[model samples]
Target: MSKLKVAVIGCGSIAKHRHLPEYAQNKQVEIVAVCDIVEERVNEFATKYDAIAYTSYEELLANQDIDIVSVCTPNYLHASISVAALKAGKHVLCEKPMATSKEEAEEMIREAEAAGKKLMIAHNQRFVPAHQKARELIEKGELGKLYSFRSAFGHGGPERWSVDGKDSWFFRKEEAFIGAMGDLGVHKTDLLRYILGEEFVEVGAFVETSSKKNADVDDSAVCVLKTENGIIGTLAASWSYVAKEDNSTIIYGEKATLRLLDDPINSLVIQYIDGAVVKYELGGIQTNDIGGQSSSQVIDKFVHAIIQNEESPVSGSEGLKSLQVVLSALESNETKRIVTI
Candidate 1:
């Protein structure tokens, strides 16, 4: 069996931390090419991964030999790069937020459909062990009719994980689209959707840049969301948690409450109304912890889907829907009214 040749566009923190390393670890994938606008970063990654390097993604995509293209670039470039890769006969595994707008996301999905290629979004939170387990439990009726939920994804800031530190693209609204919401909130939205098996129909949001000096984007944002099945929830995304990262979700049900990624040791816990409590010591969510266990199951699923000729685990359509949630929040914030998805 020949390995799938993979090319990663944008050799920044995410490329180095998740996409490249995970692809390299997958036996079915070969990290054949790496790209970055910066010559130094591209050259360094090429050496590290023992692959060819390119300063331009356009040049990398021209090599018809590449089977997959991973877009780890800024939010604004995700759609264009993914569409281009799909049009060039390459499957795309794009990072989160999918695109700056819903139309761009639709374009990416359309291009992939036209090209007949897999278009997976790197919404890794849905792949976390705890989250996977939570969904399984919920589906099996262990949680017993979920009613409400609250999720939050926050950290010190992007400087700790971004290659450019203070001047990272994450802080620029033009490049990032929406800072904390796009970077962190969307992951929670996707996760909640996956767990509850529902879509957010309405949202009321307050998106702002309360922290992070000189940043042209929101440093924090919170949304009040209502799913199609009458499920209501709150989502908080922020870069203002200077002390520690808070990646937690609490799901309330008629019979029990599921706490995910809430405890340091438990990772997942269920507290029932009848005084029965269950705890599972699952793997923790990725915090980009300065090199401490930061890979996702996304690459494995992406590879398996391609090898098996199946739909991607997080398909382009799924990405588009999740992105619609984020965009709805932005619209809600702008109008100070509940926006419908």
Candidate 2:
């Protein structure tokens, strides 16, 4: 069987760190083209991948040989690029916070449906081994009835990971939509839904651009969420964790507490009320942190979905639902009241 022809729409840090390498590793994919607004970046990635380069996504999508497109552009451009790719008869793997608004995300999904092509969101946290294991344990009722939880994702800000350093699109509200919430909080929202198998129906938040100087977007945000089944919890996304990346979650239950990616050594720690503790040495969540070492399974799953003609693990609708959570959080912050999904 001929390998699927893949084209990446943005040659940014995420495309470099996760999408490009993983797709390169996939024997079933042939990276045929790369696109970026910057000529230098597009040319560089094209040379590295032995693919064609384009400064415009429209030009790249015009290639009839392309079978799949990864929309790795800014948060605001996600819907437009994915919609264009889907209309051009190519499957799409879009990065998370699928779009700036629910309506736009729905439009992307509608376009993918109309084109009869697969659309997957790159919510890589759900693909982490420790998170997968946590989902399994929860589904098996190992933690008993869930009561409350706290999930947070933070780093030293986009200056470190973004290709353009501090000048990246991440800090601009016009391009990023909603700062830390879109970048980090949505990952937690999606993970919580996957782990608990429930939707966040309501949220109250205190989103702000507290720390980072002269930034239009948020440096820190803390949201309190209530699930449909009465599960209450806190979700925090910050770009001010200069000390270290803190991608951690703690789930409390009747019998035990599950700590995910909390400790430096143990990726998962489960402590019981009866003085028993369980620890797993799973690798850290892929936070793009220097010390964090883990590869994503997102590319593999996306390829399999295309091959099998099945919906992706993080389908467009599912991704939109997660995006709605972030939107609701933003609304909650503005209104200073709980917003219902």
Every model's Cα RMSD, please?
0.9, 1.2
TM-score of 2: 0.98
- Cα lDDT, model 2, residue 182: 89
Write the residue-wise lDDT of candidate 1 on 1-341 in tens digits: 99999999998898888888888889898999999999998999999989999988889999999999999999899999999999999999999989988789889989988999999999988888899999999999987878999999999999988999998999988899889999999999999999999988999999999889979999999999999989998999999999989999999999999999999999999999999999999978777686754568889999999999998899988998899999999999999999989
Show the lowest summed lDDT stretch of 10 residues, model 2: 286-295
Tell me the deviation in Å of residue 245 in model 1. 0.5
Compared with the true structure, what per-residue lDDT tens digits does model 2 show for residues 71-183?
99998999999999999999999998899888899999899889999999999889888899999999999999999999999988999998999899998889998898889
RMSD of 2: 1.2
> What clash count goes with each model?
0, 0
Model 2 stretches astray by more than 4 angstroms:
290-294
Q: Which stretches of candidate 1 lie over 4 Å from their true place?
A: none
Cα lDDT over the full model 2: 0.91
